[model samples]
Target: MKRPNFIVIMTDQQRWDHLGCYGNPVLRTPNIDAIAAAGQRLDRFYVANPICQPNRACLATGQLSTVNGCRQNGIPLSPGQVTYAEVLRAAGWRTALIGKAHFQNVTDVPAPSRQAAGKGDDLPASVALARREQRDGPDYLNEVRAAWAANPDRTVPLPYYGFEYLRLCIGHGDQVEGHYSRWLRDRCPEAVDLRGPDHALDDPAVRVAQCWQTALPEDCYPTAYVAEEAEAYLRSCRADEPFLLVLSFPDPHHPFTPPGRYWDLYDPAEVELPASFGDAVNRRNDLPDALRQAYRMGDEDPHSYWPFHLFEPELRRIIALNYGAITMVDDAVGRVMRTLSEVGLDDDTVVCFTSDHGDYMGDHGTVLKMGLHYQSVIRVPFLWRDTAQRRQPGVSRVQASAIDFAPTILQRAGLRVPVGMQGEDIFAAPPDRPVLIEDPGIGVFRDPDSRSALISLVHDDWRLSLLEGCMDWGELYDLGADPNETTNLWFDPEVAGRKTELLLRLAERQLALRDLSLCPTARA
Candidate 1:
């Protein structure tokens, strides 16, 4: 029998609630909705980390961030770790990665972090002035300074892991086009001039437009581009050999800048705000000041700001825009799915859809993925479409994490999971298995002090969070009664026994998963 082909489509920072199938009425995600309708959608799915690179690294290695050596965004996955692609390659399946794979660190030529750290206030006036400039400032001087300060040793010619074909962005959202532009300009100085009126340095818009033209075709936005490349690879696959294609898209992440058409697809007035929108829950103790600020900003203007604060009306608009982006991705996915059907490969293909992490679109007054354990940031959309089996379409309330994806995919492909893999194949496990999630610090570039690490264990009714350090403030919500997690039960003395029981259970769950680093602290 021919091994089934695998097509894994991953989006950047998409929230589960952004999908029409997930109950967003304004979302125009017909293609994704169709997939959910045909396949089992895991409603209680989650990611190991709320950040990008660490989560992607977990998906790649089937291990949590700590074990994979990619604990944060800037950190790269250790070269020694075994990847899902390697497993597929061993099974004689052709493997390819297209679009944003944040498996590697940003390649800094002069080491920006180093320069910024060492230069102090007395550094060259150009560098100092560059640091003071706003991200969207008039001059590209700051950008130039950043380029000079970046670590020169980090550049890799190709994508990380064993992907045979790659069209990927090296860093985060805004820098995606810029990275490629610098590379092209450096390699072909004469082919593309970087000076004078035509140069990108003169105008930032020109830089973006030029990068769009030079790096890819007109229809090739990140999401669409990855799908197109994956389709081409699928078409090129020979029947004698199975293939594994990973299509990763950088969308719905930041800059929220989908094309104007996508933005215009949804009416802001029609978009409904979330139930927890604008309401500050447990702010006295459970919420931090930084988080409050983010929520305020996100609620005020999610589109314009970098670090968003959760606001109800503004969050509605943001969600609407996010829904539009999801629709765009869904359309791209539809094309890929259609290509598979056209090639008669649908029956033998296993297509999985998920994201690196989720966005906190006004959930708990936070905008982006940051903070302790929250449903918005931790819970992600997970769907597995197995064409070989005629399984009933339904929703699974089982707690699923991003770590489970790699092992599950490998198992479905008849490949062995690596010895150190911490996740189990959800399909093979009993439906009642408890779901565990870990939060290993936050803020990609900043120190870990800004955020606290947490470990959450979710069973049928209770959701418990174990704070790693001295956080006098904590949260415990009975998800069954309060699905929105608006109330904090941690301070309720009446539920002390329940909290104790859940904490023990949380520890046991962690230990069972071989995560011995967790320790329970007494409630303050």
Candidate 2:
């Protein structure tokens, strides 16, 4: 019997409910839906954090942001950390990563957190170590677009974060540049003129922010490039060798540019706004100042990466374009899956589909993501299809986080999971534990008195979040009673007792997940 091959198809900024199988009535995702139909669909699967780099780092390391030290978007995953891909590669599996690998910072911008702080002796020793330590190397610049733009021939060093071969798409939407950019320029030199909002089709009807009708054809888009490369890799695979290939799509994220027919697959007029959209906009005064600022932004689309408020009509346009991008990704997925079957590796390969994080997508009147942990931003689709496992095919509401992905994949591949990985083998037993989400916010929360660092615990039907750097305000929600999170029960005295209990659990969970990989050889 041969070890099973792995194909992890990940999409950027896609929420759980955006898929047809996930109860999305508007999006046509027959291919992704087919994967769900044949596999176990995890209903409550959440990201370790709501941001990109941190959660992706958690996925690769099987550890939380605090343990892995990638607490925000600009922070690169430490080169010292071990990834499951490295484990599989070490075991003689041919490892390849195609499309978006955001393991490193995409831009050359310095993080605000790295700014010099005021001199303070009150800070703990751990904070001193973390703040002063230089854990990354010069290779950290491998993913920066400026570096690539300066030298198009440069590529990431081999075995990057465990991937032996990487076909990287550095940024999101059509503007993405990396190996994909070089390939696109070579394949179609004219594609350069067709990229970005400046070259968008003349469509005044769509007034959504960060959305443009790309002039590039469907085949020339990043999503199509990823599928084509993945197909080529599958075709090149030898029968005697097992491989792990990641088809990561940089679509369905920001600056929605679905090329060709994908741009108009869904009509913005027909798109439906989220249930909480109306309430959020109408009752902005009732929300915390931190959250209400989004609603006050009105019609202006700053086009900045941070979440911004949008009117119902503008949000509808975003949804429509987002749907178009998603459908394009679905088509690409269909192509890859068909290639798997064509190469006769369908039955032997484990196909898993998930996303790094999710977009706000009109949830609470916000468009992008940051400083918020609504289900719209945190919960994402997780589909697992393995032929060797006898696990019944059905929806598993058992909560799981991005950290669990690494351990689960390693266990399924019959590899020994590293002792340092904090996540459980979700397949061996239900991870009937609370999911912890950590986010060191990037100034998205505009409140001066509030610090943006957040720690949330999701268990059963209750969600509790503690906003660090400030003690006066926090969030507590009864997800069972209010799935839309319209009400924050943090101030409700009736739930005071329950909130205390959950806080204690959150503390215990945080301690439990601390890095125990380093054992002291000497007690002194």
* Top-lDDT structure, candidate number: 2
Query: Distance from true position, residue 256, model 2, in Å?
Result: 0.5
Q: Give the C-alpha miss distance for residue 96 in model 1, angstroms.
A: 0.7
| Regions more than 4 Å wrong, model 1 | 107-159, 171-175, 178-220, 282-307, 310-313, 448-451, 515-524
For model 1, what is the error of residue 220's alpha carbon versus the real structure, in angstroms, after optimal superposition?
Answer: 4.4
lDDT of 2 by residue, 1-524 (tens): 68889999999999789999999878899999999888999999999999888899999999988888887776689878999999999998999999888888888765433322577555665574445655455778888877765566776789888999889888888888888878887888898788888877857465467888888888888898999999999999976899999999998999888888887789888887888886653244544554444434433445767777778777887899899999989989999999999998888889999999998888877788875688999999999988645435788878899999999999988888897899987776565689999987644433222355778999878899977555787889899999998888998999999999999999998888988767688977
Model 2 has an lDDT value of: 0.83
Q: lDDT for every model? A: 0.66, 0.83
What TM-score quantifies how close candidate 1 is to the native fold? 0.79
Query: What are the models' TM-scores?
Result: 0.79, 0.93
Q: Considering summed lDDT, which 10 consecutive residues are worst modelled in model 2?
A: 442-451
Error of 2 at 351 (Å): 0.6
